[model samples]
Target: MSEKDTTNTSIEENVITLQTAQEWAARWRENPLNTVKAHLIPRVDINELLAEKYVVDIRAYIGVDDQGVNKLMLVGVDAAGNDLINASNGDYIYDFTQPCPNTCDVDSPLYTLKP
Candidate 1:
């Protein structure tokens, strides 16, 4: 098999979607370390729920770290409970030791209550 085919195998194994990839890219830009922490929660099952609920299959959940760095890792299993592989671009992986050039664009909550 060619390199492209090899790469595709990993991608297929790690069934990530475009929207999920974009979210990960955004998170990487916002906070690198926090992104890592978010991935640490074992109960947050991305593969199971996404496969059961959404039409699109999710192989991995991408996010940023506290240092405002982008990164992607295999954190969940497939619908068949197979281990995921890294299918993202190599150059896109952000260094978590550096400061984020841009702030997170997550929308603020519209409501606020005074205690």
Candidate 2:
């Protein structure tokens, strides 16, 4: 996947059309074995990562939990492509996102097929 330019990330630049968003969501939901539709990350956690020292971008990594469920591990990345979150500190990285299955907005087109 291509990375978005984070140098001057703006709300307008990040916003996607509804149809495009729905298409992406539908593709993910296409797989029968895919239980997790999407991850619901809180704005607070994102804000914290963005506010971190020398943080130029936030990177997301896939990880497996003890129960073998896939989860997203988020961290602040510097302009030098270095992870700003100290791995030595167990809680430095953010992984507080809740999966869409249990915490989804059912009315949204991303989660349901709207008529």
Candidate 3:
């Protein structure tokens, strides 16, 4: 498929209220095994990914880092369901999240379980 083809390239905004966001986070944290509260990725990296050629969307996958820590790996996708990544070269794919347990914002409600 060509980049000009808008087949599956329609942008859909996934907007959610803060209350819902908090509730979802809280629910995820309810599971004892889900120790990693959140993952932080730089806006610049996301911007770069979105700016890539034929990158109509981004897909995130759950992964584990070299240290056995859970991580999020992101890759750009085209309208034809093709991944915009190179396994051994380039920098489009990303796994640079900072997991919450060690780098969480103490003031954020999403980082804690409500009593």
Global lDDT of each model? 0.37, 0.58, 0.58
Instruction: Give me the candidate number with maximum lDDT.
Output: 2
Q: Report the C-alpha displacement of residue 34, candidate 1, in angstroms.
A: 6.0
Task: State model 1's lDDT.
Answer: 0.37
Clashes of 3: 0
Per-residue accuracy of model 3 over 1-115 as CA lDDT, tens digit each: 1122223332222222334334444554444476777877666667767886788898865545435565666778989988776534332556555677776787787766654
The per-residue C-alpha lDDT of model 1 at residue 98 equals 17
What does candidate 1 score on TM?
0.23
Looking at candidate 2, the ten consecutive residues that score lowest on lDDT are 11-20
Name the lDDT value of residue 101 in candidate 2: 69
Question: Alpha carbon lDDT of residue 103, candidate 1?
Answer: 26
5-98: candidate 1 lDDT, tens digit per residue: 2211232443445455567667755554453222221222333334432224334445553444544543334457554433353212111121
Candidate 1 deviant stretches above 4 angstroms: 1-11, 32-62, 65-70, 73-115
Candidate 2 to truth, TM: 0.60
**Clashing pairs counted in every model:** 11, 0, 0
